[model samples]
Target: MTMSFGRFDLNLLRVFNAVMEERSVLRASQRICVSPTAVSHALARLRELLGDELFIRTSTGMQPTARSLAMAPLIREAWKSLEAAIDPPRFEPYKSNKRFTIAVSDFVTMVMVPDLLAQLRRDAPLVDLVIRPDSWIDLAEQMDLGQIDAAVGVFSEVPARFGSSSLFAYDDVLIASSSRRFGKLSLETFSHLSIAVVSLHGQHEGVVNGFVAERGLMRRSEMFDRAAFERTFTGSKRSPRVALSLPHFLALPSLLEGTDLTAIVPRPLAKLLVRSHPLSLYELPYQTGLEKVSILWPAWNAGKAPQDWLRAILIRAAEPLSANLFDFVRPARYASPTSQQEVAASA
Candidate 1:
């Protein structure tokens, strides 16, 4: 049965989309900032108008019917069109008071946020930032629902529907305490030392895959290049032993001070660690391939003014750091000729 456009309430589509996204009445209500009863009432009106059950409550949550499933994409597209029409074409960052939510790992936060925040303060004083953890399993859904504006990390593969921009490329380096004396950091020496690693997913032995498959989304989980470490010791009988696995980089200074434990960290982070702590940085024995970090957003938001402005500022903030990522690492006195050659290439 076809219903007249005049009688059908457009507002009901908002509630419907919320329900479809959340799959629970309570969650839908919270998402739309309405009472549960209001969501239920709106669903009832929508069901009656369309002459379909629309949603059925099961043991899990609200299950959309065939008709609801068919209508969802159309409704979502219409909402996107309406939103674009309502949003201003030009964004004046200095005068606009907008809060942007971003998802980033602790590592990226430590390295990039200070610079990004300073730029924001100078350029967009009224703008605010809400940072969410990048380890969230449902991050893709959150971005799709417009809850998160963008995410920054070393993503393995970004889906076609999302747009991404490269922020910087980084390679891995090994760090140890300055108090400890060490010879050339050959694979044998690297394997013998007790190793500390930054593992966001908490895998103790093997390297975590760049992306984990969850809910049909390729969510980024791992941070370190454990694969390179493992590959360096592939044929050796003795493998590198992991003495510690940490979720963050904050305690590395104290953790490695006056100890034999060494860590493999990103070159950018290694540079920061060495400057502030009594740490010595050494080039990795094997070349750990460079990983490119990027900022990802839903493709529909590509041409939007606020998103464009945010991306522009982010690129600007990372420029100085990225320009010197490979240049900052000073090779140890016992470094191999390869390490010296690598340094020269950066120059």
Candidate 2:
């Protein structure tokens, strides 16, 4: 039932977009400031014009069908263009109350958000922040669906179609209990020792895993660089032994306690861990190269005023960061060395 272009009204698309975002006809009506009856009428016209049951009412809510899911992103993009064309661009953070959602890894949540939140408090008091766990969100799809404003973490690769900014760069390092006889480790010791590799899947296992299970997509949570690790011992016969794998980093301090296992973690995390516990940080004998964490957003979001402001704030915050604060007995550059504590405290 493809209708002739002459009979179509663009307002029908707006109604459809609102419903898709809210996932409820009643809530969608409130979002658009219209009545539920009017929403139903517009939806009926849209269904007839599109020749598909766009949404099916169920016990849960207005569940979008296959056709609706397929068309939602396209329609959202069109509606955004329409709004931009008709409405003048203006965003005042102090006066405007808008919610911004960011998809981030546990690493960023632990290391970046503290400073970011403090800055937001002074600058955008009216704006609200929502943090989505990146390991559980199909970040690429979430950005496409307009569910997340931006993604922040170390990514191996981000699709070229999206917009991104490099926030900070970091390398991996080795962490172990201080009491261990091995004051410093050699390549041979590294290969024989039991290692704990952080697996994102292991962190968000049962109930938490279900957060993304309902959606048909997958995300890579762990940030280990196996390629770089193996490349260091290219010609050597000794291979590293992996004894255990856990998902989150917060527990590594306790897990490595009284055990012969050493955990590999980002140098920034190593900085924080050594401060709180009787732990030692050492340079990796194998060269797991630097990973640059970036803030990625949808192309549709590029140049949007409020989003741009927030992005700028993140870029500024990451300016003075360096992950290898504990690389030596005293930070090579930080003569005072206490500045390492200052950087760790920033996180």
Candidate 3:
């Protein structure tokens, strides 16, 4: 246990790291560009030196032992440090097969990822993307530990060493079925009808802002604005009724069909969804202002060209969404011919 650092071969440790990640000697050998026998030998040496089985091959896979699990983080951290020091930072999307992991909301996945995937196929065909869920996870901590490459959402309070860039601005819009009765929707008309709201946090919790404020990470949970909804009518005896609360946007379309339920959601999302469904969008009756969507990454990843390049691509994809975001999600005073045309097209 007290062997000198010089006695341990770093190469064997690298093999240990690879086996831990790949969980198979053959796969680890392929990753390290060595033979399976060499990989197995390295693992054996490491197990002997560390005085633990390190990994046990089971029916499922090569499962790391308790000690291996305990030491995995330190091993990964050490490997990362070595790569930072010695590996030349390079990313050639066309030729490189690097996998990037990003944390984003389901809304973004629906609206933006199509364009992103198309562009990636055209440009960086070999590059791969791993999409992770945005909320509930510690965004900053995950990025720091290399679990997440970038985070794209409404990041409210980014912790130190994390980077962010504004992607676009969107406003909350009221989604209603075109068939739903109302020649002209008024505060009185809206007050009595049941509404659907996307719950940011599921059954157990709720927050003022979309992101979990308790965790100190700034991701969005802009499902509904209670204050804005309440403020829509100043002297009304009753507030707007919320009949349903769902966890995600996927079910909104089905839930709104053939019903009087109206949902308040982001303008960009509403616009995209209405194109296929018989839905209509209206500006929030009250002035709630624009909500910003942003791209977030670790500052340590800033100087790396591949990371920066991908960030640039994502920002580019979001540009067109923001250009006309304010036009339709605006107050009634800003109604123009173009806005009318957009609304008509959506309806």
Candidate 4:
């Protein structure tokens, strides 16, 4: 079972990779903390063993030969596989000082960041988190390019190459003023009434509009889709009656206060808003169904220690978000103050 290469030093591959990455023997030696002569000798031996030029000297720098270029990727992949196989599959939360970047929607960030930071502080205290607004088209690409470690939100479309896990589900509820008229909210009432919209991309039309369209509410849909028809509705004159269109869900409470603006917010956020502010929650005429939120990572990151740590923390944080909205297992017996605690802890 003991097979070995005859007079071939596998360490040369490491030198080759370093030089290829650095494009200069001197730089490669500096990177690997070795002498320039040692790097040159390793490259010479490698060129002879492979029977190819491997690298050609140019005015700009050392350019990789066709043969070296073809072999470099395979060599790197092999080294990665070998290292992964030898390492234990455990991420040390307290010891790691790694910086993790995550792409998330503004709504999810508003709801989950506090608790996430709290948990991170208690556990991996030194680790830093960088959050950026992730868009649908570029989410997977960002993960693929190593731009971000993970993403979280209501993902309408995700590439099959990426890995995703559903953290929790919550219902979207309508929040209106306490004095607003109810009992079968009519299209006239729906159309005439001003509304506050929260969108990550400053969109006027969203889930609520889609739900209204499903019910064949034409005039109401048009009102909801005002952004699309803005040109036709106000061709030459500016419409002054339209209320504020904000980006963050947290801003809705202040926008709605002393005004009759309505907004459809996630149930957890809606409850949190009502509890903290002078807002009221209303039962909508139709249900927009439960919104499922999930954390996504690159497929290449599966079984990775860093990915595992992030996943476990997120899943733990999502427990509170799922408790009140669904008939699922409660994180604890009493859901009110604790539920709010859970929400705030992850804030």
Q: Could you give the candidate ranking by lDDT, starting with the highest?
A: 1, 3, 2, 4
* Segments of candidate 4 deviating more than 4 angstroms: 1-79, 86-90, 177-188, 202-245, 327-347
Per-residue error for 227 in candidate 4, Å, reads: 15
User: Candidate 4: lDDT of 181?
Assistant: 44
Sum up the clashes in candidate 1.
Answer: 0
Order of the predicted models by TM-score, top scorer first: 2, 1, 3, 4
Which prediction has the highest TM-score against the true structure? 2
lDDT of 1 by residue, 1-347 (tens): 77899977888999999998889999999988999999999999998888999999999999989898778757876887897889758789999899998988888888899899999999999999999987643677777666788988877767777899889888877888877656567777776888888766565332236556543456445556767777878888898788988877778889898888888788787766676677777867777777888888888788888999998888887887689766635555236322323333443
Where is the poorest 10-residue window by lDDT in model 3? Answer: 333-342
For candidate 3, write residues 136-214 as lDDT tens digits: 6766656755578888887668776678899888777677776764544566666777888876565435455445653
Q: After superposition, how far is residue 165 of candidate 3 from its true place, in Å?
A: 1.5
Task: Please report how far candidate 4 places residue 316 from its true position, in Å.
Answer: 0.8
Return the top candidate by lDDT: 1
For each candidate, the alpha-carbon lDDT, in order, equals 0.79, 0.73, 0.75, 0.64
Q: What global local distance difference test value does model 1 have?
A: 0.79
> Backbone clash tally for model 3?
2
Query: Residue 138 in model 2: shift from native, Å?
Result: 1.8
Residue 32's lDDT in candidate 3: 93
Candidate with the larger TM-score of 3 and 4: 3
Per-residue lDDT, model 2, residue 106, is 71
Model 3: lDDT to the true structure: 0.75
TM-score of each: 0.81, 0.83, 0.76, 0.61
Number of backbone-clashing residue pairs for each candidate, in the order shown: 0, 0, 2, 6
